[model samples]
Every structure is written in structure tokens, then in C-alpha cells.
Target: MKKIAAFLLSIGPGLFCIGYTVGTGSVTSMAKAGSQYGSQLLWVLALSCIFSWALMEAYGRYAVVTGRTAVNSFKTELKFGKVLAVVLIVGIVIGQWNSLSGIVGLSANALYEIARLFLPGLPAESYWAVLSIAVVILAILYFLLIVGKYSFFEKILILFVTIMGVSFLISMFIVLPPPGEIAMGFIPSIPEGEGGSLLVAAFVGTTMAAPTFVVRPLLMQGKGWAREHTSLQSRDALSSALLMFVISASIMVTAMGALYYKGLTINKVIDMVYTLEPVAGKFAVALFMTGALSAGLSSVFPILMVAPLLISDYKNGELDLKSKLFKRLTAVACVVGLSVPILGANPIAAQIATQVANVFVLPLVIGGIIYMVNRKAVMGEHRAGWLLNTGLVLAFIFSCVISVIGFTALKDFF
Candidate 1:
């Protein structure tokens, strides 16, 4: 137990990355893809993980070498640096906060589902009940943010990520897809349908997340790592990306085995619960919901922190958790996160839409990081190599294509 705890503590930033990327957004997008198209979109998930690793390595390397965060690097390193930094900060905060709404809403709904199983007295679908749950969850999380330090956040995230990973993995084994179908998912081909493009965009957006990379430096700085730790940083990035792929792929496979073979789809959070209960039994449903709720709560911590983190990064590269600005911004984020439950929006749809919206900002983020990492003035002797640069270029191009597809999909949504 001590060894396990020590191992988890050593991978703090990697756990944070996992906590942020493999949250409710990833769960919804991956699950939807699996239910609607089987494992056809697994290609996107694979590619996104690869690019995510490259970008994280680049971002972390920059921080270790220069002791700078993304926005701080953007503000000081490139042309129109200040303008670009502000735009990046604004775009990421807006998108992440929007995602937080869905995160908390879906979390509340999941908790309500679990509550129903136990109490059997609660109304079948009570908006007020869900809202009340959301209030309680957010209140507790805000209190944690107010009092907890970075290491505290890291330890909590490690626990959540462990639970989430274990739950999903166990659930997937119970409803394992056929080996042949899983293998075919590796071959690249888009599913032909109305929402296919949007799901594709959301998958990439949720996995190869801009904020995940943009916030890497701040996280690394908070961990007190430096140039001497470059190798450790690389390993952390690889492990984070690899864990993301495994956990996300497990979710898709679980949906594929449980829903796709039966010609069903997930239209709501409750649908996941209702559909899985009979198919995989109450034990499986419990595991799935536990994972989903854990994913949502793990994400909420980072989502609430992003705005204040970015603002602090923009001002200077340090993250002051106790600052007045940090407290105020996080409070605002918590309130914004309540919007979905308050207004009674569809949490699933809100999650997917927020993810699709995230695609639009990726090109800028990829381009900015690419510029910063390649600059000798900034990175000194440790500038990015040709291989890393090539990956970044590919990631940038991919982001552009997905952004256009995302825009088209949003138009259809309206």
C-alpha cells in the first residue's frame, strides 16, 4: 500500500493530465462513438493520444528548460505575443468553464441514478433533486479548492483516477467486444452519418486537449521540476497519454459490447445506466456509474482551476492558489458550472457541444506551442527536434481540419 501510494504521488502531474482529459467529456464522446458506430472511430482516439503525448512532451520540456508556462511563453516569446496570450487564455477558460457545466450536471445526474437504486422513493426524474445534488457537489469541491494545496489536489486526483480506471477496466471486461471488431477499429475510416463528423471532432478535442498542454507548464512548475527533470517529464507525458488511450478505449469498448450489438444508443446519462443495468447487471452498472461520476469530479477540479491558472500564467508563470484572484475566479467558475443544472439543459449534449467548441481553439494552441518550443532564444540548448516538430505540424493540420468539421456540425446543431 505504501509503495502504491508512493508511485501515485510520484506521477502527480500525469495524474492531473489524466484527471482533466479523461473526464466526463471523454466518457461521453467515446461512449457515443462506440454505441453509434461501434469501434469505427477508434482510429481518431489512437491518433489523438499519439499527438497528445508529443504536445505534452513539448510543453513540459519548454517549462523544464525555461521555467515558463504556455501563456507566459506566448506573451514573451513570439510576435503579437501579448495578444495571442490573451486570446488563448480567454478561449480556453470559456471552453473549459462550459465543459465544467456539463461535468457537474452529468455528475449530479449519475449520483441521482445511484440514489434511486438505494432509496427507490425519489421521483423518477427530478430536476430539483439533480440541482440540489449539483449544489452539494460543487460546494464541497469549492471548499476543497479553497483550503487544499497543489499536492492535495494531486493526491485527490490520483485516487479518483485510480477508481475511474479500475471501474472502467472491470466493466469493459464484463462486456468485452469481439477481438476482430476491436482490431478493425485500428484501420482509419470515418463513420458515414449525420453526427459522425461532430463525434470525430469531439473525440479529438477531448483527448488532444489544448488546455491539457497549455496548463502543463504551470503544473510542472507547481511540482518544482526543472531542466534536470526533463527525462522524468517525458516519461510522465507518455504515461499520461497511454493511460488516456487505455481508459478511453475501454469506455468505447464497453459501449460497443453492450449497446452497439443491440442497436441502441446513448441519448442521455440515464440511458447509460438504464441500458447497462439489464445487459450487464446491477454490479456492472454500479461500476460504470462510479467511473463516470469519478471522471466528472476529477475533471471539475482542473476545470475550475484553469481560469485562475491561466490568468495567473498570463500575469506571471506562477500559480498562487491562495490569491484573491484565484479564489474569485474559481468561485465564478463554480457558479458557471451550475448553469446547466440550473437551466435544465441536456448534460450529454452540453458535454459534446463543449468538446466540439474546444476544437476551434486547438490550431492556435498547437501553433503557439510549436513556435515556442522551436525557438532557440526561449528553449536555449534544448529546442525541439525535427521529429517532435513534425508531430506538432501534423497535429496542427489535424486540428484545422477538425475545427472546420466542428463548425459545420455546430451549424447543423442550430
Candidate 2:
């Protein structure tokens, strides 16, 4: 029992990554993939998550051993690091903008649905009503962030992660997927159709996200984990990655069991309210809503912090969330995020765009890290082993292929 408690006590950075990773974007993507192609794409989810874990472990080790964040490594180590940081930050800002927007919009929509249960008089169908809820929520979040300490904020994130994970699992149990079919999902194979490739790539891209890597070092620093904690860091990374996979799979299974065969199209996250009913019963809507709300809240919280975190990294400034400028920047980001749902941009579409951007930037980021981590001057004895190096090389190639597929699919938009 003491050992278990110690393990929990030691966890911080990896769990923080998970809180941001398993957000509305993940839920939406997994749900769509499951509903469209059932469990045929689970292998993609597993593979993406494995790559995510590998990258995270590498990032964590770099931070703990070298005492350098990714942005810092980029600026000091590589010749074009500054230019790359600028370009990457631009991508981060745009991607996070879309992500937070989807998160706020989706959570507010779920809240509005809940409001309808109690206040039948409320205009439940109104987007403005949802927008109003989102505004209030974001305002509360801003206020909490400004006033709350890091420990308080971290606790809130853990709470959100717990609520979302438990609620989703409960809903999954109620829905009860077929074990035989789910078992076959372990075998990797793209579905036979036009959407299959896109869905497969999305599953890989969305599962881990680019922001998680950017925020990882910051979170490690925040946790006060040092080089001595390297083993702990690996444990935390593995544990969090496994938990992320479980939560993601549970969501996929829920969708597969409920909406897959019905031929129902899921365009919005809110559609789950209706689609989940027949399989999990009406009460399950509330469970799904609870999980979705938790997901959105957890996601929005980190997303709001992202701009400040990255900006600090770029400028080599202290990561002070309490600073007036940081708070102001975060406030601006919140407003931009809220605009997505208020302006009626589709959450799923925004998620896909952000994910594609992730894939597009991945090779460059991964390539740079590979160079940095392999240098004896940088890592010395702590450099990546052959196994990690091999995994990373494969991940870089895989990410490039996924990016090509994504760009090919969206060539018309370009």
C-alpha cells in the first residue's frame, strides 16, 4: 500500500501529459473512427500511442539529464533552431487555438444538454446558449488560473482526468462491446474504402498530439523531478501511456458497440448524446456527457496555458503563469478558443486540421530531437539506446507518410 501510494505521489509530468492528450479531440476522433469502421483501426491507436510514449520518454530523459527543455535544445543546439521554433510555435498557436475551440464548444454543448434536463424552459437548442455557458466556464477557468497555485491547478487536472476516465469506462461497460470483434482489432489493417486511410492517419496523429511533447519538459520541471528520477520518469510515462490507450480504447469500443452498425454519421461531438442511447440506455447519455465535459475542461485548461508555456520557452523566460502578461496572453487565447463554437466552426473539422498540422510538423521535430539526443556532447552516457533509436527512426518515417496522406487528402483546401 505504501509502495502504491509512493508511486502515485511520484507521478506528475506524465499524468499531466495524459490530461491534455485525452481531450475532446481524442474522444471525437476515436468515436468517429469506431463508428465508421468499427474496431479495425485500433491498431493505429495502439501504434500511435507507442510512438507517443517513445517520444515522451525521450523528451523526459533529455529534460532530466541535460536540464534543457525542447525549445531551449532547439535554440542552442541546432543552427536553424530559432527559425524552427518560430515556425513550430506558429503551428502550436494555430493548432491549440482550434483544439481549445473544439473543447470549449463541445463541453458547453454538453452542459447545455444537461441544463435542459433541469430547466426545460431554457433554450437548449440555441448555439448562443451553449456559447454563453462556454463564456462563463472560460471566465471561471481564467480566474482560477490567475488566483490558483500550480499545485491547485495540477489537482484540478488530475480530478478532471479521473472523472473522465471512470465515467467513460462506466459507459463502456453499459454499452458492452463484443469481445471477439474487439480482439481482432489487435491485427493492423486499413479498412476498404476512401475514408479508411484518412481515419487511420487521424487515429495515429490525434492519439498523442504535438503539444504534449512541448509541455512535457515544463511539466517535469514543475514536478521537481530530477536526474535521479529517471527511472520514475519511465514508469510514469509507461503508466500514463497505457492509461491513455485504455481510455481511448474504451471510447472507441463504446462508439463501436452503439453507433457503428446503425449507419449513423457523427459530425459533431454532441451527436453522441443521441447516438449512445440505444446501446447504453438513456442514463448513459449523462455518463457520456460527464466524461466529455471532463475531457473538454481538462483540455481547455492546458491549452490556455500552452501559449504562455511555449512563449516562455522561445524567449527563455520563467514559466510564471501568475505574471500579468502571461495571464493576459492566456485570456486572449481563451477568447480565441471560444470563438470557434460561437462562430459555428465544426469541432471535428477543427480537430482534423490541428491533427494534420501535427503530422506535418512531426518529422521536423522528431528529426531535430533525433540529432540532439544522439550527440555524445549533449547526452553523454544518457543517450538513447539502439532500441529507442530504432523506434524513433521508424516513428519519423511513419509520421512523414501520415503527413503525406493528410496533405494529399486536403490538397483542395490548400
Candidate 3:
């Protein structure tokens, strides 16, 4: 019992890392993909999980041995120096903006659905914004008021993850997924329509993109003591990340496997959560809404941690996401996130767009990290092993090709 407890405890920063893996993008974009393309893009989801593991594992090791965040490590060892820094910062800002906006919008979509039933008297559009805001307020209060439990940050993240799992799994069973269609999910193929292909790429990108992946070491640093914790931290972080991947892919497969099979196409992000009874059944509605609500809340907590990290890095090259400026940034981002309804209430479209942007932004970030990390000076003896190097190179090439193909496929789409 003690051994098991200690093993789990060694993954001190596990929750925060998982927070990045499980976010609003996972819910909206993956749901859209399943609804639009059925399981045609299940391959992307599987591939994304693999790449996430590689990318995050690299990021974790770089931080542990060097005692630096991925950003700082890049700055220290990068050859192009100023030019690359500018590009990285730009990408980070845009990615962060789109991500936070999409998450807020995703959360709002769930609230909008819930209100339509529970408080039919209120306007869903505006009331959703208010509800989302209240959720942020409530979460912040919970984080602040919960004392020692939440100050750790990962504790709250763990709670969100637990609820998310229970909620989504229940939804899956409630929907009573068709076994044959679920089997077909593993058979990879591109869907026929242009929209189907686009959703596949967008879904892949969104499921993989989030703040915590890049900023993991900072959160981990606050939890564990030093360089000695490096390998264990990486292992723990990877496990947590995989847990999220399972939950995310499960929701997508279940939603797509069942709903899309019925010939009902999903047009908005909220449609998955709200269109349950109208299409599938009352149980479907309840299950999806429950999953969506949990997903929204789960995502919000990590963004709160991430906002401050971005601010601190900008102002002081530190990841002290606790300063007043960082806190204000987090709050403002939250407010902006909640206002996603203004971007067009077509829940699925907006969700997919942000996800597409993630696919677009990925090449830059991933390419930069691969170049920076493998440099002998940066990692010394701790550099990626030769086998790992070969694998990473292949993964990088594939990512670049798919990303380019995806962008070109949707050319002229602004």
C-alpha cells in the first residue's frame, strides 16, 4: 500500500500536465470530428496521442535536467536568437489567444444548453455568458478558498479530471454505442467530403494543443524539489497525459460512433451536448451535457494556471503566475473566453476554427523545440537517444507534411 501510494505521489505535477491534455478543444473539436467524419479520423486522434507523448516527454526532460521552462531553454541554447524568440513569442500569443477563446466558447455552449432546460425563462445566448462568468468566479473562489488542497493546483485539476471521466463514461454508456461502428473507428480512412477532412485535421490539432504542455516544467517545479525528480516527473507527467488522451478519445469515438452513424451531422460544438434528446434520446442529452459541463470546468482550471505563466515569462522571464499582472491577465483572458458567443454561436464551427489554428501553429512550436532540444550544447549527455532521435525526426517530418496538406486542403480559408 505504501509503495503504491509513493509511486503515485512521485507524480507530483501529474494533474497540471493532465489539465493541458484535457481541455475545451478536446471536447468541441473532437466531438465535431466524430459528428462530421464518423471515425474516419480516429487515426489522427491515435497519432496525436503518440506525438503528444513524444513532445511532452521531450519537454519534461529538458526542464528537469536544465531547470528551465521550454521557453527559457530555447532562449538559452537557440542559434538564431532574437529572430526565433520573436517568432516563438508570436506563435505562443496567438495560440494562447485562440485556445483561451475557444475554451470559453466551449464552456458557454454547455451552459447555454443547460439553461435552455433548467431555466427556460432566460435567454441562452446572453445567459450563457453570465453562467460562464459565474463558473469562472466560482472556480477562482474555489481555488482561493480551498486553502492548502488547491494551492497545490494539481489537486483541483485531479478533481476536474475525475469528474470529466465519470461524466463522459456515463454519457458513453447512456448513448449505448454500437459495437460494430466502434470497431470501424480503428479502421483509418479519410472521410469523403471537404468538411470531413478539415474536421479531421482540426480535431487532431485541438486535441493535442493546450497551455500546459509547453509550460509543464514550471508547474512541476512548484511541486517537486529538484533535478533528481526529473525521470520520475517525466514518467508521472506522461501517465497523467495518457489518462487525458484516453478520456478525450473515448468521448470523440463514442459521440461519433453513435451520433454520426445515425446520419445526423453536427453543425455546432454545443450540438453534441444539446442535441441529445432531439436526435439520440433523453439519456444521450443528459450524458453529453454532463460530459460537456465537466469538460468545460476541467479546462478552465489549467488556463487559470497558464495565464499567469505567460504573463510572468513576458514581464520577467519567470513563470511566476502569481503576480497581480499575471492574475489580471488570467481574469481578463477568462472574461474574453466567456464572450466567445460573439464569435458566432455555431458552436462546432468556432470550435473547429480554433482547432485548425492549433494545427497551423503546431509546426512552428514543434519544429522549434526539436531543433533546440537535440542541439548537443543544450542537453549535453542528456540529449535524446539515437533511437529516440530517429523517431522524433520521423514524427516531425510527418507532422509537417500533414500540417501542410491540411492547410492546403483548406486553402483560401481565412
Over the stretch 1-414, how does candidate 1's per-residue lDDT look in tens digits?
999888778779988998889999999999999999999999999999999999999999999998888898789878999999898888888889889999999999999998886677978899899999999999999999988489989988998999999999999999998899998999999889788988998998799888999999999998999999999999999989999999999999999999999999998998888889888998899899999999999999888999989999989788779999989999999999999999999999999999998888899999998888988977887999999999999999998998999999988977
Tens-place lDDT digits, model 3, residues 16-82: 6556656767777667666666666667777777777777777677777767776665565567645
Clashing residue pairs in candidate 3 (N, C-alpha, C atoms within 3 angstroms): 268-348, 269-347, 269-348
Each prediction's TM-score versus the true structure:
0.98, 0.94, 0.85
The segments of candidate 1 whose C-alpha lies over 4 angstroms from its true place after superposition are none
lDDT against the true structure, each candidate: 0.91, 0.79, 0.63
TM-score order of candidates, top first: 1, 2, 3
Using lDDT as the measure, the top candidate is 1
lDDT of 1 at 283: 88
Q: What is the per-residue lDDT of model 2 for residues 1-414, given as tens digits with 9 covering 90 to 100?
A: 677545545676766787778888788888888888888888888888898888888888888777778876787778988898877777877877767777788788888876665566976378777788889999999888887366677778877887899888998888777799998898978788666666666666666577788778777777777798888888888888898899999988888888887887578765786687656666788888888889889888888988888888778734566777788888898888887777877767777556555566777767877887788887889899998898789888888888888777556334
Poorest stretch of ten by lDDT in candidate 1: 115-124
Candidate 2: give the clashing pairs: none
Assess candidate 3 and give its TM-score to the true structure. 0.85
Best by TM-score: 1
